[model samples]
Target chain A: DQQVKQNSPSLSVQEGRISILNCDYTNSMFDYFLWYKKYPAEGPTFLISISSIKDKNEDGRFTVFLNKSAKHLSLHIVPSQPGDSAVYFCAYRGSTLGRLYFGRGTQLTVWP
Target chain B: EAGVVQSPRYKIIEKKQPVAFWCNPISGHNTLYWYRQNLGQGPELLIRYENEEAVDDSQLPKDRFSAERLKGVDSTLKIQPAELGDSAVYLCASRLTGVADTQYFGPGTRLTVL
Candidate 1:
């Protein structure tokens, strides 16, 4: 069973625009959500995270919004740049084991 | 400081062959993790180690997959008589003992079983 799901497989946006990636989860117990960016042939790197207690968290151009009622979260990048093109994964930390449950990732393309 | 290091970035072998992958975590990081990522899917945890002890390995396929983190620094994962379905990218990650959410990952080893 896939606990986390990213319905969109890919997204395309022009530079200087906004990019939004969405994720949904089936479990309500997940309290922490994180986003990771991955380049080709490289490992996923941490981007932004949000706690269940907060509805939104922002780091620079990246922002994550969580909605407990909808069991959904989203990562938004304003004024997206070409360098922001990569695969983005949405994950949640397991409450008991601290392990991560990840979505099937969304490939974002920021074209110049 | 160096990040997590994994050797033999790529490997290809027959279904019945045995293969091993190695990992060296960042200095002073006592936690280590192994994950397998299939095509078009996110990574799934195989095991987690604290120091030299494996604290979580419920996802590991113990019948053919085995792992060891000796001396609490470097680690190795071995698969014997591999199956064709085992082809995937294996990733290693590490974090400081007290860190809760952040994990640094290595480049990973891509394995192909023919």
Candidate 2:
């Protein structure tokens, strides 16, 4: 069973525009959420994370908003650059531990 | 600090052949994890180890797959009589402590079964 889901398979955005990616989860026990960026043939790298208590977290040009009641979260990247064009994965950490459950990933293409 | 290290970035083996992948975690890290990632999908945990003890391995296919972290440091994952379905990227990650810690990932070893 896929506990985390990224409904959108792909997204295209123009350079310097805002890019939004969404994720949904089925488990309520997850307390920590993380975003990862991946390039082809490479392992994912941690981008940003948020604690369950917070509804929104921002890191420079990236921001993550969580809605516990809806079991959903989103990542927004502003002034999207060509370098930001990669697969974005949303993952959740276990309540007791840091084990992660990941979504299928969304491929974002930023056209310059 | 050096990140997790994995050897043999790419491998291609025939079905029924034996294949092995090696990993060396970051220095001073005590928690190690193994994960399998399929194309276009997210990674799934294969096993987790604390020091030299395996704490979780429920997702591992024990029939033909086995792993060992003998010295509480470097690890090896082996598959015997490999199958086509086993083709995927195997990633190794290391954390400084228990589950709540952040994990650092390696480049991963991609296996292609012919």
Candidate 3:
């Protein structure tokens, strides 16, 4: 069973628009959530993260919102640029051994 | 500083053949992880090591897979009698001992078993 899920397989947005990617999880015990951006043939790189204690965390043009009651989270990138086109994955930090549980990932395309 | 390094970026072999992938984590990082990602799917953890000790490996398929981390710096994952279902990209990641979320990853080795 997948503990984390990215329901949307892909998302497309115009440059300078906002791009929102959603993710859901079945486990409530998780406290930390992270987003990673991956380019083709490259490893996933860390984006932004939110702790359960807070509902939102923002880093530059990227913002992540968490709704614990709904067991859902979303990543928003404002003024999305062409460089933002890539696959994005949502992961939760495991409380036990600190391993990461990742979602299937969503491919984001920022068009000019 | 160099990031994680993995060798044999791509490998192709017939079923029942043996294959090995190597990983060298970033300098000073004590935690290493090996994960396998199937096509169109997220990466799944196969094993985790804290230094030379494998702290967790419950997800690894021991019947055909084995891994070793000697001297707490580099690791090797080996698969014997590989099956067609073993086709996937194997990724290696590492982080500092106290860091909980940030992990540097290598380009990964793409393995194809025919």
Q: Interface RMSD for candidate number 1?
A: 0.7
TM-score of each: 0.98, 0.96, 0.98
Positional deviation of residue B73's Cα in model 2 after best superposition, in angstroms: 0.8
lDDT for model 3, please: 0.94
User: Which candidate would rank higher by DockQ, 1 or 2?
Assistant: 1
Q: Which ten residues in a row have the lowest lDDT in candidate 3 chain A?
A: A93-102
iRMSD in angstroms, per model: 0.7, 1.1, 0.8
Per-residue lDDT tens digits for candidate 2, residues A2-110, read: 8999999999999999999999999887889999998887778899999899999999999999999999999999989999999999999865365788899999999
For candidate 2, write residues B1-114 as lDDT tens digits.
888999899999999999999999999999989999998799888999999998888889999999999999999999998999999999999888844456788999999999
Clashes of 1: 0
Supply candidate 3's per-residue lDDT for A18: 99
Give residue B8's error in model 3 in angstroms.
0.9
Model 3: per-residue lDDT, tens digit, A8-67?
999999999999999999989999999999899888888999999999999999999999
**Runs with alpha carbons beyond 4 Å of true place in candidate 2:** B98-100
Tens-digit per-residue lDDT, B1-114, candidate 1: 888899899999999999999999989989899999999999999999999999999999999999999899999999998999999999999988776678889999999999
Task: For all candidates, state DockQ relative to the true structure.
Answer: 0.86, 0.74, 0.80
Q: Residue-wise lDDT of candidate 1 within A1-112, one digit each (tens)? A: 8999999999999999999999999989888999999998888898998999999999999999999999999999998999999999999999645588889999999999
